[model samples]
Target chain A: MDDEVIICRCEEVTKGEILKAIEQGAKTITGIKIRTRAGMGLCQGRTCGRLIARLLAERTAQVLEEIPPATVRPPVRATKMENLVTSHGE
Target chain B: MVNKADAVVIGGGVIGNSIAYYLAKYGVDTLLIERKDLAAGTSGACDGFIFLQSKKPGFDLRLALESTRLYENLADELSYDIEYRKCGGMILIETEEQLKAIIELVDGQRKTGLDVKLMRIPQELEPILSGHIIGATHSPLDAQVNPFKVVLGFAQGAKRKGAQILTHMEVQAIRTRTVRGELKVDSVITERGEIKTNTVINAAGVHAPVIAKMVGLDLPIIPRRGQVLVTEPLPDLVTSLLVDAEYITLKLAPDHRGTDGLGLGFTLEQTASGNLLIGSTREFVGYDRRTTYHGIKAITQNVLRIAPALKEVNIIRSFAGLRPYTPDGLPILGKLRGVEGFIVAAGHEGDGIALAPITGKLIAELVVKGKPSISLDEFGLERFK
Candidate 1:
């Protein structure tokens, strides 16, 4: 984990932050997601999810397949708050 | 010397990457050819929602369920983050008609052993949703991931396991041969040169139909365009993924404004970045990936009705991608009837991101071991015939 590199841009989470989370007892994939917000950033973890998962595996001495994959929810893009309000006005 | 391999997988989206990863993990010599970078198609553009609730009953639901399970373990197996979150999912019901439709969907889900429940009042939706809600149905198993990272992670893992990935390599044609009067796929003619291989897997996303046509196969795949909008970062306002059943119905409805023979559905998801994802419009505009104001407005209207607080969120950008749709709303997988060593793994439409893991695993198993761990007859190309 690089000290200068940021893992999650939205949360300012870094690779060190994620590795630390794993070291501190984040076992499940979601546990790491919550503690470090590694995969929770904009770009929706599209850039960092696999990277974090690899780091977690290295820290936990676990097989990659044993660690569950992240779940995907839809609207797969972000909607405008204005759009939500305006559409309802109709 | 040009290396020979057991399989050559075209396309490097989640499907192609996943197939390559699994095949290599199984110790098969595999070569993955991509026209551009990984996840360059719909996999790069759309939200990675591994949803099972909205699938049609029977075979579709069954396939989605199995795919969901595979997603659960993909992160560990691939050693990639993939941002997999099972924050659950909700379908908001604004009208009684929508509620009734949801009930039917719930019934269908239950028949397939899925745990889907309908909320009679808005109180039961408290933990899952915020703001106004008429009624809603909840599914604990629904989840999301970042599409780009997942595909790249698979590509990385496949490469690590001895799979050769050629980026910026486009397949110009599929070369077939007559060995003792029997036709077979001999190799692929690419922009670089000819690579002779025993097996060819078409995981080409929207461009799959073109590849299939090269082999004299009719895939019945059409390009269904979907538009999406991205907003600037905000607080974590949405905990679970929120969907409006009306939107799904409207998207699926034939007469909906955005459904230009495709569908009209808008989904709202808040990313870890504090930004929100509003999507999308389904139109049958062939390979045109441009976004339109009309489509954005329709999607915005739908989002505002569910969460009025979103009125202040700043929209930064919007984009669109093409979903590879089939006539029966199912993807074409497995080998075509007459084409030996030629496999089809396209037409997943919007569900490509959701079903990538399972699709890849199944295709790898079918190609390497002669059969998939699961029965792929339902997803086979024969369904079209």
Candidate 2:
């Protein structure tokens, strides 16, 4: 892959950026996410999560299945603050 | 895994890495062991607010002030861009009672040599804030940094200074021996092998009590969980580290359980990348670091109350971290009474990011010179007794 090719479309993180984070001892998707903001954007790693994980596995010489996914937090889908408030007590 | 070192620091969070760096710089043969990667716990999961005004008056504020000075020169000294930024901070005051309380708190802080003052909501923040937020307190000293970079910087700096750092190595046992009818840390037994060392610094954070238990000592540290939310990257919305005045009340008052028993508080910070890091709910839920639906709702409600304009902001995700809480809010630092060569520097709770550099410097000083320049009397482990 070309170094300039974008990996995380939401964040516009390039392949070079992901590679740099990997070189700096980012062994997991969470590590790469925090280091490069690759998967912390609108999709919250949904779009680019697997691509980055594969890159990490290939770079670290680990099996693709061995690479863990980035931690998925609440509000899995992007939701507005007002939506939460409007929902009220269930 | 070699066999020996002058000092063996346990846990590789911000605290442990800082201690390792300072020890190595002071010419101590330092070896640090981490169960996981650096900042994998609270340090990585928490926000990067090096806030001062919210600290309890006297010892806590004083230590924070000293730590601030160290943080100012840290990025340059460590030769790593920890993204240290003194963007300043503010506390949003809503109620008349909040204003009065903040005034009294600011007065006490000013007396402690902290440069802080109460002020009207600034022109920039006026549009975003709700009408209920009548006033604010601004301090030029409160700053922030990238917590991950800070931990990595310390670990790298320690390595550059010839200190040995071992990650993915869990300590199974703390080997100690009795000499002259007193307990002394002999070495640490890890999954790899036993490391021979006379001194052991416990910086295990929320798991500190577990480490202390290996030596038949019961530490009073409890895991207090805090949950936070992250918004999608947007144009600079709210600037600086902004918190609700009630956040201070929640932090200082132990009995004041917040909205729905979640201990909710509103702390807003815009990251360098323009993503707003909103937080948090403080709950004592043992070791569970899971975020709840109610916790998320409470924090969002708080954001809307503080900055109604943020009602439209889309939240990307929410996460939780466990803070090491003690009986008193202050961290447990300095040596233990019954143990020789055993020093503790954990239980910083939310102040871990703020106090990491100074804690490292002081603990290093305590090890090298047998005492820190500033008194550790207030932070001693025996205070629980």
Candidate 3:
């Protein structure tokens, strides 16, 4: 696969990286956002969400818009996952 | 007996409120109804850019020009502050092809008596922009306003003039009655109850089709979703509205760039509160109002290209709104052929905020006087047939 096909514009993650992540069982956009940090930038994946959705659809052979949009958590920017997990657990 | 009025304007967005305001001013008792809070639809969520630069070279341009002129004095006429700023707009051209297109656009604009000029390395284009650009076209008559304030002002003004504006009043169906040989709209059944009236105006924005269907009329209006983002206030990086011609082909103008279905794009603008409005994405994904990562990146990347200095600005929030799009990109206004007393003022699409005041005035004229001051032949509902 061509590296020029950028799957995630936020982390500059290429299609190859997403495909590799998928192979490692990173199925959802949130999962990919956590693992590869593909959408964990200033925009929080507003730019890369649709592209990731399309890539997911093409790879999985599903309709594009039918794929549920990424869950938009408040403070829309990137947050420390550890902090969230610890706060919830406490 | 149920409460009644001469006319009921459905959908309490800018269009509905403006229509109700004008109607009441004309001494025609009116009622304005909204399913949610006023301006809850595209009216509240959009950057109120009253622009003429991006309009297609013919009839649409004329509509924009007329609306732009009306917006110039709307704040004063309504005796309310709508933050109407006649700040010029620039369409940055990155390639020779785009420059050619800009030239054509300028030619059309000049023919229509618009104050437009193609700027090649303009000196006035300063601190507002922080990137390399090949060329740009400037239109001095373009302006911006706070959509929320404008809608509120219209609604308040309408209420002050005897129009009963009711929020959270959803119209369930339209009740028809025969007067002599002619069929007329008698009342509107709401979720709560019914309000009897002689006339009904459909300004339901994205839900215009649904409301029209209640009266057995087919209104071919589809929801075109546009997502917008807001950045924390910076020192006025973008003074005048800036756009990219190539981005226009992608429908990714600077104000509403990211969330539309178009690939990585951004439109940047500065509000009176000093916050930067960055946007957006345009997609034809039915009524889904979800924002995607691709939409955000598209806007961010485009914003960076236009103003690299904005890299440090933190985006505070992001949102999506749907524009009621017609197939030919023109609005469906005026009364339906077979449906008596049922008029449509929806499908202004992305231009709704800009076109609201004029559309209201026109609808008021059509309803009260049986014809409009301007030609409504092109905007008639019969075009769908």
Residue-level lDDT of model 1, residues B175-228, one tens digit each, is: 899887777999888888888898999999889988888889888888888888
Which segments of candidate 3 are over 4 A away from where they belong?
A: A1-90, B128-131, B179-182, B250-266
Model 2 chain B lowest lDDT segment of ten: B118-127
Name the TM-score of candidate 3.
0.79
Query: What are the per-residue Cα lDDT tens digits for candidate 3 across B319-379?
Result: 7888888876778999887768999999988888888888988899998999989877898
- Per-model TM-score, in order, reads 0.80, 0.95, 0.79
Model 1 bad stretches (over 4 Å): A1-90, B122-132, B250-262
What are the candidates' C-alpha RMSDs?
9.0, 1.8, 13.9
Window of ten residues with lowest summed lDDT in model 1 chain A: A81-90
- TM-score ranking of the models: 2, 1, 3
Output the lDDT of residue B36, model 1: 62
Model 2: per-residue Cα lDDT at residue B83: 83
Candidate 1 residue-wise lDDT at A5: 85
The best candidate by lDDT is 2
Write the residue-wise lDDT of candidate 2 on B95-171 in tens digits: 89889989999999999999987778653544677766778898989999989889989998999999998877899
TM-score for chain B of all predictions? 0.94, 0.98, 0.94
Which lDDT tens digits does candidate 2 get at residues A1-90?
999999999889999999998886778888787677788788888889889988988899989898888887778699999998777553
Candidate 2 predicts chain B with a TM-score of: 0.98
lDDT of 2: 0.88
What DockQ does predicted model 1 obtain?
Answer: 0.14
